[model samples]
Target: MNTRWMARSALAFVCCMAANAWADRPATQTERQAMGFDDPAQLVMVRDLPFPADSDTRAPDGAGLGDEWQTRIGTAFQGRTGAFNFGGQAPSIACTSGTERFATATFDLPAGAAIKYVDMFAYDNSSSEEMLVFLLSVCQGTGGADPPVSTILANSTTSGTPGDTVVTLNLSSAPVIVDRYTCRYMVRVNMASPGGTCVGGSIFLDKVRMQYTP
Candidate 1:
């Protein structure tokens, strides 16, 4: 395996370990059941928004990402298949420079579905600097600028390779019950602070999965 793959694998292992540890919690198990979550059928009501395979194709249906509503497909790397940069340039880019560049994608869930968990699988190209945040709601207002952000799924610094960091949020603490036409799940990435080395400066988004029950 290549170095990139090795790094990504190690990161994935760490995430799994963390998830396993969380699974061992009694409160977590009860919450999981209350939300209708099972490892095998966890995604029964999930709605996914994956990056396009390349520039030739368009982002799936309502899925999109960019700083200014631009859909820039990230350049695929050696082992990071189907991975795209959420903010900054692919391969690598100069320091963020403190302007707060970002990449956001939104997914609409079924009407009247109850969301249980929100998970995003992505990472920073460079070291641990970039951050990931989520905003989920039932009735997102009309078109134009981004919606009002309230729920934050993950607000910690990146800690792995460019495509293997998994950020999972348990909505059990604050159950999100959709009563409107549909529930919108949004993933927002805040680029790392500028002035760092060039190699680890971008955020790579691989996939997003939502667990819900209608």
Candidate 2:
């Protein structure tokens, strides 16, 4: 074999081995950046309000909303009476109001984090009403003065029945995401009638989490 040829062949083999090694190893920093995975920030804990402390007149049980963080709505309803209770077992928090119901809560995300997703876990505790309708809204900036970007996260006027149920809403949907920017957002829980005998029931929201994929 010619020495020059042998040297060239050896170089090619070395290059092949290097390529294979790179392929076998997990994605590296440079490779991830090339694939748009650059420095993605992990979602940190934001505000989590369960709602209805003794001070909160909205909770039904008067036990208040419990330890879970939640946004509460005060005398916003015209004829509605009774605090929207967060505490108590099944059947307690079921929506019982005859008219459109609205409840408000505040949530604070860290200053610069981009909220990628919001997950809500709720249970239909009503025995009479088989279904419920609800909406979740988020507001930017502060107070009622701020125009809220509202989305009907869950509209279960037909399906879903009473009992422990899990519903997932993708924030990427048109109504949920609102915009690409990240700022402080509020979540509003609204219940509406879908006609028929309008059964009064309660709904217990277990958990609401915001996922920030920065």
Candidate 3:
């Protein structure tokens, strides 16, 4: 018997056994439903605001420690300006310097739409700074100091050493339900630093889309 032929025969037999094992695995109820999965079409795009270079507004130098920083959203959305701020000294704070700007926006999902996913693209435009962190918050209605229905999806500071450009964030792990009863959802981007001198620069956000998988 040829040694090469014998070796080839053994490999073939092992591959067949592995395939058989995988085919015999049981499927869960959810898996069975997902087998015929067809994602839902997007119903509406309520607010699509771009965080360009001009979107950033400088705050007063050494302003109050706990002040609300906002970016004007023009008359397009009823003269609304997105609100953002640095967290207190306890956990973490937003942009450390005065020139840095944090931007936020709110959008209303359709009346009876189930929000399956949210896709975010952010550009960290800081040449000297190597890293920057941002936060995404989802809430029921748009108002003062309300808790988010889902947990806060905080993205670790991505390396800016490679140069500032758009980076997409996957929201499959943090899906929120937006049905007829739901009112509004908010997305906030802020500088993430515990206690350090904040360097001021610009970050761009674009191509933000939400899909409903009803």
Candidate 4:
């Protein structure tokens, strides 16, 4: 074999191996820039709120307006979707008066981190079932403006037939800024319907997940 040909072949082999190694490994910032690729920022799952089976407010027990809704099993104002059962906004307090029917869950968010969005897994079994998710501050407001900020993360009005047609409500566009030292935010799920229409079929909240960016 010619020495020049052998040297050229060896150089090509070494280059091929180096290219394969680079492709196998995660892309570095410089490599991505060279390829004209901007690695997309991945959403980080910061919190997951699932319905507790042994929840006290599952059925007979009632979750009155402005009540702590940690347990979510047999609570008042609930409906079943064959696949899963969830709490609904029955005995709605929002229409009744200043009070509102909501289930509150607190989650720890790191200080200075901003909320990207929230995912609410639920199904609307009835027409015009209004589901509202809000992110509230945990402490008093520095300027005394409502003490805490109540930002609406997600809101959906169901308009489909009653069935197991579950869907995910994405509150991606609404990003709430987290700047509290406590690093805690309260999530409230307010499920209800039009005035004077508290029926059995309401929006059922099955699960909730949130993402944030530091």
Candidate 5:
């Protein structure tokens, strides 16, 4: 098999491991019960936002990466098979310079959904000098397109290990619930400091991985 396919297989296996956690658990009342049967089956809800190359806008460079989330365009990457059908440039975002820059994306998660894990796939071409930060947040989507962030649910940093390949990074945190309709899920990426020699556009945010249930 090709190297890309192998990488994808590994990623799929890793993702399944997360779903396995919710397996064997009692089915939710709204689930199989509504179907008129009591068969045991776990439900996995995943919402992916493929950071389209043209979707990011420059955030205020003066903030410390807090409630300064700006607006971005696009819906969840779900149902977009064309997104993965890559022949040329794949979708992604990168650090402009060594100074920290932020690219934000919106995630449309179902109501009453409990998030299990927030994961991100990162590509590090140079070294540790090009580490990136991935975070999950919730904010009130008021004031038009821009939303004011309220809480930072989870955050994680890339190891920059295996320097030339893509690795998975999990934002280690417990499950958090969001009930407010005005508030929405946010995925913000803080590009690495001194962004490194990966200047060939090597060091960048690849794709986001999410494991949760609705």
Candidate 6:
């Protein structure tokens, strides 16, 4: 009976140790693959990227009036399909003739976030005017006006004429690191000559996508 009890105790201890070992062990490669899990090293997630901009603030609602970025009105975003100009406008925002007009969308990111790249999916069919996008860091929107403290980070080409084109500001080589107080970014659509040909303006904007790491 004594020998039997000792054998049972040893087996129980071995079982307990095996359970404890696996409790803290990382999943094996085969197990991870069976669960359809991505590699942990490539587990980048989006934190500040806007979801509302997918389809926000249509042309009729005075969506972007005094200030372009309004959090109350559709998550502080604006889009253009070329209504007031050769590109588009935010209803109340000036889509004047002659001078170049811009349809810009703003983004607010956390301090430690990093900007990987921006993709502007656009269609540029206008030979008279142009529609090119730029990613920039501005000091306070118009607040950086007096001297215009602006830095042009990256820009896309204007050759997406008559078809679907994706212009990218890829910085995968070196992502733009940011801080809350020091960095504010925007995607500006340089729409040349607003209101001149409100009817049938050539360039059209499909969407703007920002890929980042937080």
CA lDDT scores, all candidates in order: 0.42, 0.38, 0.37, 0.42, 0.44, 0.50
Superposed Cα deviation of residue 58, candidate 4 (Å):
34
Deviation in angstroms for 211 in model 1? 1.2
lDDT of model number 4: 0.42
State which candidate has the highest lDDT: 6
Predicted candidate 5, C-alpha RMSD: 19.9
TM-score of 6: 0.49
In the range 1-214, model 3's lDDT, one tens digit per residue, is 7999999999998996554331112323432222211222211211212222442222344122332222212111110123333322322233434433334455555554434334444444555443332223333555645543422332334456343343333332323344445345544443322222344334334334445443
Tens-digit lDDT string for candidate 5 (1-214)? 5999999999998996565442123324542222222323333122232222352222344222221212232122221122221111346555534322444566666666555545465665655455443334445555656534334444445555644443333222334454647666766554444432224355556666454455
* TM-score against truth, every candidate: 0.42, 0.39, 0.38, 0.42, 0.47, 0.49
List residue ranges in candidate 5 displaced over 4 A: 1-88, 96-100, 141-149, 164-173, 194-198
Q: Which ten residues in a row have the lowest lDDT in candidate 5?
A: 79-88
Q: What's model 1's TM-score?
A: 0.42
Q: What is candidate 3's CA lDDT for residue 8? A: 97
Instruction: Give the TM-score comparing model 5 with the true structure, all chains together.
Output: 0.47
Instruction: Pull out the clashing pairs in model 3.
Output: 132-157
Q: Candidate 4: which pairs clash? A: 57-75, 58-73, 58-74, 58-75, 59-74, 59-75, 141-147
Show model 3 residue runs off by greater than 4 Å. 1-101, 125-156, 180-183, 192-202
Better candidate number, 5 or 6, judged by TM-score: 6
lDDT of 2 by residue, 1-214 (tens): 5999999999998996554331112334533322222234411121222222344232242122221223222222121234433333432243353433443445554444433334455556554443332333333544456444332333323235566664533322222223325343554444323331223435554444444432
Clashes of 5: 1
